[model samples]
Target chain A: MAEKDGDENKVAKQDQLPADKTQTVDSTSGTTQDASHEVQQELVPSDARELEVVDVREGAFGVRGTGDTSGYGGLTRPVMMPGAAQPPFGGWFDEVHDRLQTLTDSHDDRVIEKVVVDRGELTFFIRRHALLEVVTHLRNDDALRFEFCSSISGVHFPHESGRELHVVYHLLSMTHRRRIRLEVTCPDDDPHVPSVVSIYPTADWHERETWDFFGIQFDGHPALTRILMPDDWQGHPQRKDYPLGGIPVEYKGGTIPSPEHRRSYS
Target chain B: MTTVNDPYAGTTESTEGPVFTVTGQDWDSVDASVVEGDRIVVNMGPQHPSTHGVLRLVLEIDGETVRDARPGIGYLHTGIEKNMEFRTWTQGVTFCTRMDYVAPFSNEAAYVAAVEKLLEIEDQVPEKAKIIRVLMLELNRISSHLVCIATGGMEIGALTVMTCGFRDRELILDCFEMISGLRMNHAYFRPGGVAQDLPAGAIEKLHSTVRLLKERLPEYAALCNANPIFKGRLKGVGHLDLAGCLALGLSGPVLRATGYDWDLRRTQPYWGYETYDFDVVTWDEPDAYGRFRVRLEEMWQSLRIVEQATERLAVMEGEPVMVADKKIAWPAQLSVGADGQGNSAEHIRHIMGESMEALIHHFKIVTEGFRVPAGQAYAAIEAPRGEIGCHAVSDGGTRPYRVHFRDPSFVNLQGTSVMSEGGMLSDVIVAIASIDPVMGGVDR
Candidate 1:
């Protein structure tokens, strides 16, 4: 199940870090791989100063061609993401990174995939296989004791192609009085990431919540049942593909459309 | 040996004896299971009064001693996070404010602060606006704690404690209504600042309310602080040490009760909280009684912050509460009209006649809302319950890409099993009340 094909599933493992960190993976190459490939692409930064265009959305209100009576038919915008940060990340972020690196340096491949310092916060993107080890170190290490796992939030980006699901763990170190974010990604087809319940018992329900919403299965979760949704519910309601269910409201003369059917701006 | 055939009970005949398969029948009627072992499973509620807001506890008890306890939530799940994805950034506040109904200001503050951080306008948010936000949040803390004490006291059959708690809480609600124009679910805290400035006579009302609360606050101390029965019911019950709290990721009064002086307001100050003076109330005992004392004392600290804010608000009259940014700040300034509340006449005139550009901006802002740069930021605040954090992701659009709240109640609720297991079945209510998990937040 963990086997990978050449080039197609290269980004899936920690060993295949893009040599040119600024390279962008085309969506077609990542999407065409088989389910067994377990393709996962790390979000590579394109430029140091500019925003990396993740997707180029065309025609406002999701309309294309002559159907768009609204004059925004020709308009297009690039959905951008901030690039990875350079070394010497201001404040204690550098020390945490150095300590985490020192602990995981013996490994064949780097555990820290990419570091993103955005909006006065530090985010460390980690590989799926190394997530448990990294989290345990963060908790047990006296130097970096992120003792409290604040919450686990799952983000499903269908546009990310190979890596369609992302799990972010917000950790708070009360001992050091610092906070850092750890993010791990997995392919939508094989959404199996290691569960950190062994290290942090509080992640029990949070992992359940992430699974309930995004359907990202934690491989070793003792009882990974839906927490906030009914057990018999069909689809993960928070996924981008799932429809926002609502009924149309009827006024005296005309019926007002539901939210999904209403005119959209983006 | 019974003559009547019971259709409800699915019974089958075996060589040794007649086996009864329990299906939708009364659990007490299942004698075969009781014979196998002394332990019996009981479902407390998705509807019981003491469970507090649709939280169902599945308890496996052996002769009134709980062998195991598991919480069954999601009965109150409203999918507010999913709903916020479809709405504009400014409109997202309304959805999140309703998450923890008791402390709506904390929800709004965390969300709005996160949005401002994503916008990189955290510093640009007016000083007066931060003060008001802090003031409203402190007031909300008092109200939320009052409800916790009131409902917690009611669960233990203390009628007077419940009545007095609510009575004092009503005064705080009046202050909230006087300023935000609503008693609860006040979507007053916006992205740039608050929805509007403090209304006329709001200061006087706050002063009077604060004075009255100070007078009546001691009633709770006199009533429950030394009462032997209250002490008997709460002391040493739901005991979770500092290690247990750290492992389970508990915070607020629950963690503070363990004698840890960790508070987001003190440790990681936001919205100029470091400038204020207040103690992080804590207790050495890690139990229901300790949590109760922590909450009771935290209310006094919150009142101190509230009083300081009221003094600052009196002098900073006529200062702009919203940010100066034309692109981000809300376009309309509301006023009380002859009919009801409506857009200010000056703003209306400026948009209608003064400039066409202003008119376009007004239309654009009101209809589509302002856009935030693409990125994600997590803003955590010390809410009345615990650490309430908002993780907001934007795709450089008017609508949010994804928004998730790390509601303290939700995380703290995970400790129910750990706290209640191996204890008397009666103490389950005390354990839950001490954690104070708001189902609205837990199931959001």
Candidate 2:
């Protein structure tokens, strides 16, 4: 089991790199490709080229000698965590962003760190304190009316420092037929975000699930117990650092390494 | 006074009168006040067959009336969402399809839709592919509802209905096998389009099954709907009004049964569903019987959609099913060989002996898989149970960064406490059966 407390500064290292550098796929897949040595190529810069490769994890490929004969086994995949999007944010995204801005009066309203519009969906990376208020306004505002709390999902990014753990909320407006995502990050040390059960009772199990899998705690939840895994299980399985823990399987006088330890192109 | 399988006919069966420390029942820390006033606490199965796949209910009752109900879940957690992180984007479909074993197509659709949205190829997808997706999902809805009524009818002690329901469900499965080779868990819908076009005469096979289901629905209505015992058990047993449905995030039949027109297919139209003409079936009675009526009516609506899709697909033959872009698509060109469904022989020959570039293209796609740009998307669809949503995040790699399913079963499980609180213990089973939760979806 790793330390539940994640450092806040770890994720800041992502912004230091220049935004335009191209990332190589590398020989992530490691089997027969060793002889072929697939040449590195630059990804075509379309609308997606603007996103930066902020962080890369160690051991991008699986462990060696696990029978990973697929030449792509040495694949060390570098994750591209993109930077914040600029203004004029297109379509209904601009209206949602501008409307929420008027509702809040905080002088230091750095609630929205980045505005990312990708694949026709808008994601607001909000500060932890603004979650409850912003959600309440979204539900009550006649213009927004995001009455439905669709889902609350947990995502763990081990290499992205400080803001290592993310709790994502998918909110829907039945009246407007629009959906927006709200993501809040908490460091490993204080993985606590105020519970929104009072506002949206449906968030109860989702919060429990996020806690069960990512170990990010919701401070005021009624019952903060594990919902999916056994009550007394040890570590959060969904975290990237956690191993999948599968032994190689033997079949018909041949052996195949578990996906956990297989070599892949990185 | 009751000697009919009443093991405690002579002796009393109350907390104060006698103690029964059953191995499965556990309500140790309940309030002391409820312990008095002729109350009894019984723990009903993480393994009990009628509870619908490993769900355990802790019920506190006074005589036959339930005072409080607490649900204990997680017996069937396969950690499927976690396992998806290890596999490729296309392979994630296999794991996701297994989550809601009852409605595997809807599960597959939700996951793959998110992947397509991330790739930003949503609009460029071929028209015929969208039609096939609609065809498969509607067929899946019918089969899933059949299982629902079949098992629910059996749980309420109607053995004949169970036999009929499962028997009819097999026909739907037969059509499914014709399309994707597998009867259940068919990962038919790939990111860009379907894995391949419809097989020869597959539409005719679907037409026959659709005709059969349309005819047999009325027979089902007469046998189970009009039966007084069936009505007595389900009519007002698990009553949930519009308020309860809205607060609990309930959708599909349960919400529709409350006279709320909240079907996602009608309201949030996906995959050209808006182009089709169909009613969003609703019922005045929000109870177990109401859900049954809503399900039966929805089956007819599904039949209508399937009939329409089959007609469109007949004209759409020879059109492309996979995307024109080669980067996102798989290398295999699916075809029905003599033995079973497999890759095309012509395409195989071209790659092997005809062209070296074709062989290299095939190798690259097969080896690395496809890459999706860095972003996140949430896609939801109307499943048999309720609204099933998939939240997919890509790190611009061949594999998915993170994926989570907002299973309708998990959200609706909380309602067991609300509905069964003041109802009879027998009605508790009826109420749970009406919810029609698949534990595989709930725990995953």
Candidate 3:
């Protein structure tokens, strides 16, 4: 531990280099590229020319890369890959991706709705009814082995046409420092999703919280109790339709209703 | 009382029925009323001092042992998350800072980082601002850990340790007051940059305090760790193995205690944490004692980072802490009234008479705040407790579409039951305290 601290200290001290030494933008090119890479390659692709390797030391490298194609605006400087050789849990992301591909290939087109890749993390949007089967495949499939449910959070999209409530499940592979998000959406009136507590006992409270805030019921949860909000609290507090506050105090002859009391005409 | 099929039975026969019983019973008249066993329930707190806050635990006791313990939260809920929806983007900082009052800077930094991510303006944050943030956050981490150590000690019957912990923590709060102008919930960290630059003498004070803490920490460790009673009370109590912690999404020292080395600062760097040198302290014991030791060691590591960060701040003496982007950062040197409030008579007159464009722009920005492009982003930071993440969604509007905080205390608190389930009832207090949950952060 002390050795690690010492190495980090050395790196931090080296990082105190003058800002000018790290500056990449040149007046001539009007673009920033790795100064060290200029000698190794010639005529870099116009699109890829914006990639600037900010720092390169030891096994780690920081690159300021642009993502214009994915509609991801602005320059993103992801610390591409850490210095560690093995992904925290060996081959975590790779196994999940391969398993997901195999499952999607065998499943019906409607069962596997969409797959969106945001940066390195993958999100699979399956049909609400297929959530149980998909999650089961991910958990039980020897190759996939997404044994842990990192989080289960609910998102409300009021303006969306069909599915207004999105239940997002974050899965992590402890053996591999890999993560994937599983999203399933259902209409606001009937927000029911199959519970994963049967597979992972840790999902008990997370599912309860989702139920508490978004009013999404997880079938087969042992105790679907309110984890955060009061047991008798009215409505789903996180829903866009729910008002922010309900405290109302009338002073003198005038009356002032809290934010909750104000009617949502829409 | 009636006993059956036992050698040393109190009474073999009853007295109310047509049977012969003990000394007081008449022949042919005996009563047999067997006592049924039912579980006794005890409510531990919504106001109990030992509960740490308004936390209530309903325990089902079978004799002297606890059969089931259910935690009841939300007594301290203030609806801060819901309130964030009604405020402007910049105004949300004031609310987020209150969530983790012990380490307000972490909450502020996480919230602002999320906003900056949505705006895609993180890189544009000035160098000085990053250093200032690291400085404030490390100091906050130490202060927060001190509170945990103190309160945890108090919970474990170490009264003197509490005094030492609180006394050391006050020094950090004094530093906070100097920099942010408030002891707690300062709202010092804003979207584009810090609310203001570090005050004069803040670095000098931090240097002396860090040195003092480094010297004094060993005494604290000796006081708590070396004592036989303290060790006996904590050593093997409330053990949550590595698998249990990982399954429950535990982070910070609690997770580290279980032999997992996961620190967002090292794994996923932010706020120029990549430029700081520190260790992700860990222990394999995975017990209450292990957690206590990890937090104590973490304080020393935090002090090291503070020393180094303070040196870096000294180098960037007078650099602009706020971003140069006028669209994001408010202009410096705004004229103030005698009451020290902005929008004074002179300021408004100058803006209206001299720079009508500035007046119009200020009015528009102040009224609506800056609009973030429609997108979603999740930014995580290492708070004193664990991984504090902000998942923000924007719909190309001044108001955020959705803002959800993955508070570490909340996630870490989930592992409490896993830690205490099979342990003794007395172990429950140590287990809960080891997690060091601030209910404000959890229930936010």
Top candidate by lDDT: 1
| lDDT (Cα, tens digit) per residue for candidate 2, span A12-84 | 4434434432332222222122212323223322232234344654343545556666664545444655545
User: For candidate 2, what is the TM-score?
Assistant: 0.87
- How close to the true structure is residue B228 of candidate 1, measured as C-alpha lDDT? 100
Clashes of each: 0, 49, 9
By DockQ, who's the top model here?
Answer: 1
- Tens-digit per-residue lDDT, B236-336, candidate 2: 97888887876677777998999988878988888899999888999999999999999998899999999999999989888998889998888787887
Error of 3 at B232 (Å): 1.1
Error of 3 at B84 (Å): 1.0
For model 3 the local lDDT of residue B3 reads: 33
CAPRI tier for the interface of model 3: incorrect
**Pick by lDDT: 1 or 2, better one:** 1
Put down candidate 3 lDDT per residue, B85-183, tens digits, no spaces. Answer: 766678789998999788899999888998898787888999889988998898889899899989988987899999999999998998888778789
Candidates ranked, most accurate by TM-score first: 1, 2, 3
* RMSD list, candidates in order: 6.7, 8.1, 15.3
TM-score for all models, in order of appearance:
0.90, 0.87, 0.77
